[model samples]
Target: MDLFDRLQEQIGTVRLPLFAVTVTAAAQVNTPLIAILHWHGFRRATPLVLPGVEIPSRAVPGSAIQLDAPWHSFETVDAMLLDAAWQSGAWDVERVEQRGCNVIGASAAETLACRQAFGDYGEDMVRDPQLLGDETDRDGLMQLAARRGYVRWLFRPVKGGLWRTLDEPDDTLEVDGGRQPPCPVSPVPRRPGGSGRTVYRLGKVHRILLPR
Candidate 1:
């Protein structure tokens, strides 16, 4: 099966009556993902953590983040374009919109965003109805989130992974046979006259042979 199908099976069946999936690179070529959750009627978001999951890093080409959103939030989301925050790498971000019971949404986010967004929703700081209450402008809040570090809201939706990543392109740019993990540093060619211990980059860590 292709990568998407496996993810569907691994992700299992969710309770959302309707949801949308978009394809975005998780990181440069084969790095892990930086998924985020956007709940309806809330201005902020939390990490989209898929617990106890182990699949090939390549199997997850794009986002695995799930969002439980209301109609407004769902409609605002586009498959081609998605919401994401910069962490260290610039890659496409996949967003899923789930509308159903038993799925995590705004109520949960109010607590989750306590340290991330502001303080608690109502205790330490007052909840902004315009940002969180009915018809919540999630995009607006995320756009405003750009100002804060540690966590950034995707207005145009950008990338990063723990720390800033190299300016290399993700796996999508390469052909199937050429796909490989991102090298932290670029490989320098051997000098014309110099020889001992030439610096090199490994495209496939598992391979025993060196490329000619």
Candidate 2:
């Protein structure tokens, strides 16, 4: 069984607010979603920090997402939370420290290298700067996030969303309006008799962001 299928058997349904992560060219940081998050009463900026970048709704000196590579070693559970924190910038170190977030005093230099080098997924969508730790292990982390209900929003740098409008990017993927795009990753299968759950072909590897 694939990772996605295995997760489906383990965890039934995830009840959490959709956590989204978005990275675009520096020019387009303040997109509609940022505004929308603000509109939804998310006054804090800590939730918007990702690896190598911090997307604060309102910039605050201390509220930063510190992307220390050594501190963030690659383990399935840690990787999931790291990616979620990297993607959504929602993790409060002070709050989640009880849940295994300990600062090991590593350098954010590795994190900076990733962002400066690729800055999210590069062309062909194969190489993401953030996925550098352990390519083989990412799937496990992805699955774990689903099992724990942390895989809320897997927003990539695609055709639309807040980034597109803000960047006015030329390489945006085109759509026919009727069909949705194919998922970036292959899906895991589902187990029989799963309640409140339907097996996704991509197996919920990426968080789905429904535009409201």
Candidate 3:
């Protein structure tokens, strides 16, 4: 099946914890994210980590580390980080959203100012009503959200080992045939014929893979 479907089969209804990773190439700035809880409110102010490439002490003001190789060495670093996260089982796919500009963990006030400066540049997917009893769930999702640029809530629903993209563009992108995973049929909701209620199959949870 496609990558999304395979993810679904792995993580059932258990909502996984969110982990955010922001990278800055030399002079470039960092992008942050926010999280949304399945049954609670938003989360922010989680311990976000920054493990950048080790560059020579003397180099361009803002250039990321570079090494001469047949292919791009940076790609190797990225793969290593992704693999590490997958093994940790603490984080899922990395969410991508457009922040006003890349700003690393400068300060809470400064970050808030930057977010306010942007003023709704990206989509906000937090639609569930703000509940008060789910402190644990809210905390986890919020930390995940803070790490991303925009809050793209990653979810893997139950039934049908299918990986579905939520509010993100997946089907529109192009990819190499050899590298692309098999796409599976998305789960369908069962029809309710005078029944009190029917269960809709949500997708599964698997590792998130960002495009190169």
User: What is the alpha-carbon lDDT of model 3 when measured against the actual structure?
Assistant: 0.27
Q: Which ten residues in a row have the lowest lDDT in candidate 3?
A: 59-68
**Tens-digit lDDT track of model 3 for 55-137:** 33221111111111222332333333233223322213332223322347446653453342222112231432232232223
State the lDDT of candidate 1 residue by residue for 47-141, as single tens digits.
45568954322111122342332222211222112211111122433222211112244355523432233212344234232122333233333
- Per-model RMSD to reference: 20.8, 18.9, 20.1
lDDT of each: 0.26, 0.24, 0.27
Give the range of the ten consecutive residues with the poorest summed lDDT in model 1.
79-88
Q: TM-score for all predictions?
A: 0.20, 0.19, 0.19
Q: TM-score of predicted model 1?
A: 0.20
For candidate 1, list the clashing residue pairs, or say none: 29-171, 87-160, 87-161, 88-160, 88-161, 88-163, 89-160, 89-161
- Candidate 3: stretches off by over 4 Å: 1-74, 95-212
Give residue 189's lDDT in candidate 3 (0 to 100).
Answer: 26
Top lDDT model: 3
Better of 1 and 2 by lDDT: 1
